[model samples]
Target chain A: MVVRRPGGRSARVRAAVHQAVTELVAERGYGKFTVADVAARAGVADTSVYRRWGDLEELTADVVITWLTRTSPVPDTGTLDGDLRTYAANVVREADGPAGPAVLRLVIALAAAGETGARAREQFLAERSRQLRTMLDRARARGEEAPEVADVVDQILAPVYVRSLFGMGPLTGELADDLVDRMLGTPGRGPS
Target chain B: MVVRRPGGRSARVRAAVHQAVTELVAERGYGKFTVADVAARAGVADTSVYRRWGDLEELTADVVITWLTRTSPVPDTGTLDGDLRTYAANVVREADGPAGPAVLRLVIALAAAGETGARAREQFLAERSRQLRTMLDRARARGEEAPEVADVVDQILAPVYVRSLFGMGPLTGELADDLVDRMLGTPGRGPS
Candidate 1:
């Protein structure tokens, strides 16, 4: 079967390349890997990857940076708790495919890999920090009781990321709801 | 200047090997590197490393597992809050040395690198989790209001590890103190 795209081929090429990298990293991780492998996996000419990215590290950086920047928008599900729960669940589900936690592990490993990785890590942190700050601001604008932003960020969100890295239990909406209620100084309805 | 130690030469050799590996990772990031390089840096025979650990990844695991297991003892500062603060400060200071965060980055990278790494990573996490459970149990025995253990662990300790991994900011006694207080439901001394 043959498929055709409506838009420019480059966009589809970029998408295929990155998606292939994600799958490879999730399966075998980043060690002793090659860009040629990614190119072949994408069904693109190895020359396209070689001409553009040059190496595995640079190619990995491009894929991670794209994933970080292109995640879903900050939610506005009416209530602060509702938005938080929805977003947290969405974040978890997005990475909870057949790949399991390999995608998240690969992202963290890439960020800690080297100079190229350090750059991606910092950019991802900065981008996510902005998203959190914006979501908090939006919640406050909606007349939600403003909570301690740093506490919510460092204490609540950090755990989610850390535990995710360890593949510790499932990332649940109940867990997100507990975090939201705790941050807002409200009692949860106990696990239903 | 030659100094002699009372311990056997094997102990001295192991110490030098680990110390050399740490220094190398700190300076070079854990990119493509070799065990022969580590042995050369440590002034040990490459065969000694090859005989004990088959590859750079396994050797890397040894260095990190030793570091994680031998970190500061859990503090017993009378009160749970005081103990938590002291231990947290101790953890932060331990990683704030010449090797800096690079050693940590390397450890995490090695853990995610392959099968040997995955085993080492699990060992490290399990060891730390046991230590935390023990500490929380001691606090409860001492009449502290027992909060949810997983929540307490996730909220108070996870941030410390997350922030350390990211090099996000300085880990301070003040920060640890606040985490302990927050877990205990005590109002922070300032900026709520």
Candidate 2:
């Protein structure tokens, strides 16, 4: 068995294929294109794509995982409030970015797809949960009060994502701060 | 213009066509079928669908509006807490229902399709906001404090929709109540 070197030809091909997949998904939406389309768009051999990814679903999942991993690095501010604000801001920025809508569409499509898509969605969410836990755990260790992982998901992440998904309005930094403030019960706005 | 009676053949045909559109969207996930397909499934003439909706996007928008109007009625339980709880519970129920996923998928598809889809998404969202405003206005008129419609959208509606979209877990009435409690800062878990 041959081992592939990191940051080599394999990496380049993978990046090219993933970019192609994202463009296709954004332009045509899910299931409208195929592995061959990706191959052609990437200027690679169709056999290579087939051999590497096995199917369109697997390839799409890999694209999602890769995209998410590259984009969202959890913030590590010293205070829980700072950390959460930064985290929420990062989320808003990403969701409003160029690739945001495509990735959002991809995630929803994967979740709605059958078993394989469900597994991909699970892996994506589990990774997100793990990231949040790391931030919250760090906050708790420093004797800072932190909301539960689920609370963060519901209050911060979910709302940002839903807003992006539905195009409710511009996802502003102020909105992120407000969410954190509300969750932490800081002196922002009282329950009216 | 020919006069069409309410609750007659016109209504029956509309119901059939709408049901057919929902089923198709549920089964195929959008952009897979055509007017002929819808007409065949709906047991109505293709021309009738064309004359009524003009295109799939218009038909889809109507479907979304019809579904949302039928499913969610603003709840009034004489208190802000009770009203929010019941409203959130109703949302959870609808999102967890048989047609929930279909509608969710359709909305996303519409939003991503183009200008037409964007308009549909806006219409759907505006109607939801109207419903929330009606509830909040009533509460305010009764001298009860009420959250802004945007807050409810972000805190309650967004989380539920995002959860349902991602298949995070079972959306329950308790969860709905918890959301309301968190929003209102009632006698529940403190900020932590």
How accurately is candidate 1 docked according to DockQ? 0.20
Give the DockQ (2 decimals) of all models. 0.20, 0.35
Residue A29 alpha-carbon offset, candidate 1, angstroms: 8.6
Candidate 1 C-alpha lDDT tens digits along B58-141: 677678767765675677778777777776666666655444356556655654465746766666666667776777778889
Per-model TM against the reference: 0.71, 0.86
Model 2, which residues run further than 4 Å from truth?
Answer: A1-6, A31-59, A186-192, B1-6, B27-40, B45-47, B50-56, B186-192
Stretches of candidate 1 exceeding 4 Å from the true structure: A1-7, A20-66, A69-72, A95-122, A170-174, A186-192, B1-8, B20-62, B69-71, B95-100, B110-114, B146-149, B186-192
lDDT of 2 by residue, A1-192 (tens): 877777689888998999899889777777679888999999999999999988888788788877776687788879988888888888888898878877987888887776867877887888778878999999889988777888888888888888887777688998888777677873222242
Q: How would you encode candidate 2's per-residue C-alpha lDDT over B2-33 as one tens digit per residue? A: 87677689889999999998889877757778
Each model's fnat?
A: 0.21, 0.41
Alpha-carbon RMSD, each predicted model: 6.1, 4.9
Tell me how candidate 2 scores on lDDT: 0.81
